[model samples]
Target: MSAEFDVRYTAQLARLSLTDAEAAKFQSQLSQVLVYVEKLKQVDVSGVEPTAHSSEMNNVFRADEPRDWFTSKQALSNAPRQANDLFVVTKVIE
Candidate 1:
């Protein structure tokens, strides 16, 4: 990887302002990280299954049972303002 290209491209994408010294330092560090990632790609994983999560978890579920519901008056009892039994707020957009 070209360190100079990497530094210039990253600065442009992030709209960052970096001094000459900082640019050079970042170039070297970024190159090292890319090299390490390239090395990691050489690992073999034949017959290995991919998983979204690491832990062994089954399909967790809850019972579908009816429950008591709250009325609008009870729900908005502590609200600052209400109109027609509903919470009211200031207009958000012009």
Candidate 2:
């Protein structure tokens, strides 16, 4: 299909209203992209395996370890209102 036709069709599908100048601009850009894609098709990759990423990836998380628990007084220090070592807030359920 012609690049101009493809541009107009895509714009229609996307619900975009493009002026003649904008359509022409997008047509030129789309033609360049199609040409680059065609050029890429010429490259040989018979021996290369397809990969999701270009580089090797590994998990970045640190090891989990046990730690001391905070005292109830310390935990409730920042509470706006506390009763019986527990936070008190407006009831959410009706």
| TM-scores, one per candidate | 0.41, 0.42
Compared to the true structure, candidate 2 yields what TM-score? 0.42
Mind giving the per-residue lDDT tens digits that candidate 2 earns over 1-94?
A: 3343578788999999899999989988888877777776778988988898767886678769977898999999999999998999899999
Q: Candidate 1, after superposition: displacement of residue 1 in Å? A: 4.3
Clashing pairs in 1: none
lDDT by residue for model 1 over 1-94, one digit each (tens)? 4443578678989989789999889888888887777775677878878898988998999999988898888999999999998889989998
Off by over 4 Å in 2: 1-5, 12-15, 58-94
lDDT of each: 0.83, 0.84
TM-score of 1: 0.41
For model 1, state the Cα shift of residue 69 in Å: 23
Q: What residue runs in model 1 are displaced by over 4 Å at the alpha carbon?
A: 1-5, 45-94
Give candidate 2's error at residue 59 in angstroms: 8.0
* Cα error, candidate 2, residue 64 (Å): 13
